[model samples]
Target: MYLSYEETKDIAYYMCDRTQRLTLPMLVNLLLDVSEKQSDSLERGEAYIRDRGLNWIILHYAFDIGRMPRLNERVYIETFATEYNKLFTYRTFIVRDSNRTELIKVETTFALLDSKKRKMARIPEDIVAPYKAEYSKRIRRNKKPDEVNSEEYNEKQYAVRYFDIDGNNHVNNSHYINWILDSLDSTFLLDHDITRGVITFNKEVSENQLVFSQSSIREEEGLNSDHIIKTEDTVHCSATFTWDKVKRRNMNGYDQ
Candidate 1:
C-alpha cells in the first residue's frame, strides 16, 4: 500500500470568497499543488515525466465536500496513489479540519499524454513504481459526467489568459473549474455552496483561445448545475455540480 503524503495549509484571504470560505477553484488548485509536491519529493515530478516524453493529464474528478474551509483556518490535506491500470491511474485526496473531521474527499483519474503526439499513452511500470501504486488489469469505471442538454443556459466567453497556461503549454485543469463556476450568476454563487462535483476533461484548451462557458440549472432532488466549456471546434470539458443552500452560520463567520 502506498503511504499517504500530507500537508497543512492555512486558508488565505485570496483563497477565500466573500463569505470567508475557501473558493472551490482554489481548493482544487490546492489539491493539485499537494499532488505535485508529493511527486517532486519522490523525484517523479513533471520534469521526470516530460523527460520521458510524457505529461500527466487529468481526466476526471469527483468531489464530496462536507464543508468549505474557512479563512485563516488551518486544514490538513492528505493524498495517495490508490492504484493504476493500463491506461489510467486513480488517486484519492482527503481534507480534514484541525479536529480531524473530514471536510472533503476526492477521487481523481489521470493518464499519461505523449507530449509530442498529444495522444494517450500506456502507463509504464517504471514511471509509476515510485508511487507504489498497485498495478491492476481491471479498469475502474467511474460514472461519466452528465451531458448538458440543449436547454437555454447562461453563457460567458473568456479569453484564456497567459497565466492560465501551465508549464505543460496547456490550460491548467483548475481553470476549467473556475470557468464553470464563473458562468453562474454571482447571486447564485453567493447563496449556494457546492456539496459535490464531477468534472471530466475531453480535450485540451490552449493559450489565447476564446472559450465559451455555458451552465444550466436543474431542480430535482436538489439543485444541480450542468456546465460545458468549448471553443469553436471542440468541447473541451463538461461538469456537474450539486449544491446546498448556504447556512446562515457559515455566512456570518469572520471575513479575512
Candidate 2:
C-alpha cells in the first residue's frame, strides 16, 4: 500500500535535521523503515523479512538527496514496491514538499539471506506477492562495477581509522558519505550545495581496511556536473553528486 500523508511527513522529518534538508544516509534509513512498516502491515505474518536475522544487510542501495527549498517547508517521502525477481526485491522512493510533487527519486535491490550461513534465501511468498501487486512495472537493476577495472583509481587512498567502523564491524554506510565529502577540498564543498546524488555499494569494506577514495568530474555546457568514488584497485562504488551553485543554508556539521 502507498504510504499515508502523515507517514510521509514523519519520514521527512526523521531524515532531515535542524536545517530541514535530508542527508543521503538519512534518506536511505527512512526508506528502509517505510519498507519494513509496509511489510509488517501485510495480512500474513511476513514482516520478519525485514529483519535479516540480526540487522538488515543491504544487498544494494542507492539514493538522491535534492536541494532544500526553504525552512519549515514540509517535505514528504514515500516508498513503494517496485518488483521482485527470484532472489531479489526492488523498492523505490520519491521525496517532495507539501504539494505532493517529487523532488528526488531513489531505487534499491535487496536479497533475503541466512546471515549465519551467508547464503541466499527465498523471500516468503506472502511478502513477495504484496510487493509484486503494488509495483507491476519491470525491475531495472543497477550495474555493479567490474571487479578488475574498478582498481585503476587506487592512486588516491585513505586509512580507515578505528572509529570509522560501526557496531556491525564494517564501515558504516553513512561513513561512506563522510569519506566522499572529505575527498573534496574545503573550497569545493563550501562553494557548492549538493542538489542530487546517486550512489551504489559494490562491496563492503571491513574494519581497519585501508581503502582508497577517488573522484572525477565532468562539466557539460548546461547540464549539472557529475562526480564518482572508487576504492584503490577496485571501484567499490560510484556516485554522481550534483550541486546547485546557489547556496541555501550552511550545512555545518550535517554529514550523516
Candidate 3:
C-alpha cells in the first residue's frame, strides 16, 4: 500500500498577492516542497537520485481550487504517489484549512530522465520503493490544452534568469506558471481568481534564452485563458486557466 506524507504551514506575507491571498505560483512551490521533505525524510533526496545519474522531471499538473488561503492562515498539505508505470508516476496533493476544509487538489505526472543520455528512463524500483508507490501497467493520459494561436494572442518576452534553473539543470516548473500568469493584463489578473488550471511542459528552457509568453482570453461561456510559452517558433509549454470573477465584498472571504 502506498503511504502519504503531510506537513503544516502558515501562509506568509511573501507568499500572498495584493489581495493578501496566497499566490498560485507560491502554492505550487509549497506543495512540491512538502514532497521534497518527504523524500529527504526517507533518505531518498536529490543527492541519492543524482548519484544514480537520474533526475526527476515534471510533465503535467492539474489544479482544482476551492479558495486561496489568506496571509498568515494555517493549512495542512498532504502528498502521496498513487501509482507508477514503466515511464510515468502519478502523484496527488491536497491542501486544507485549519477546519479541514479542502482548499485545493493538485494532480501531477512525473518521470525520470537519464542525465547522461538526456532521455526518459524507466522507473527504477529503488527510487520509488521507499515511497511504496504501487506498480501498474496502465499509462494515464490527461486532456491536452489547446495550442495558442500567436497571431490572435497577446505576447510578452522574458529572458531566462539564473535563478530559474533548478537541480535538474532546467527551468523550475513553478516559473512556467509565473510566466503564464504574467502574460495577462494586471487589471484582468487582479479582477479574477484562478479556480482551475491545466499545464503541460513539452521542452526545457535554459538560462539566457529568450522565450515568448502568449495568452488569449475568452468569456462568452465563462472566463478562461489559454497560454503558451515558446522560443522563436519552438513551443515549450501550453496551459489553460479557468477563473472566477472576484466580488469586492466577498474578496476577503473568497465566497463564490
TM-scores vs. true structure, each candidate: 0.95, 0.67, 0.94
Candidate 2 per-residue lDDT over residues 71-180, each given as its tens digit = 34566767776666666667777778788777777777766656567566766565567554344345456744222223333235676778777554556666676666
Model 2 residue 184 distance off true place after TM-score fit, in angstroms: 1.7
Q: Which numbered prediction scores highest in TM-score against the true structure?
A: 1
Task: Give lDDT: candidate 3, residue 54.
Answer: 92
Q: Give the TM-score (vs. native) of candidate 3.
A: 0.94
Rank candidates, TM-score, best first: 1, 3, 2
| Superior candidate under lDDT, 1 versus 3 | 1
Question: Clashing pairs in model 1?
Answer: none
Model 1: runs farther than 4 Å from truth?
A: 249-256
- The full ranking of all candidates by lDDT, starting with the best, is 1, 3, 2
* Residue 114 in model 1: lDDT: 96
Cα displacement (angstroms), candidate 3, residue 128, comes to 1.0
lDDT score for candidate 1 against the true structure: 0.90
Preferred candidate (lDDT higher): 2 or 3:
3
* Deviation (Å) of 83 in candidate 2: 0.9
Model 1, range 1-256, lDDT digits (tens) per residue?
6768999999999998888899988998899999999999899998999999999999999999999999899999999999999999999999999999999999999999999999999998888888888888888877676666677789999999999998888888878988999999988998888999899999999887899999999887799999999999899999999999865634454332
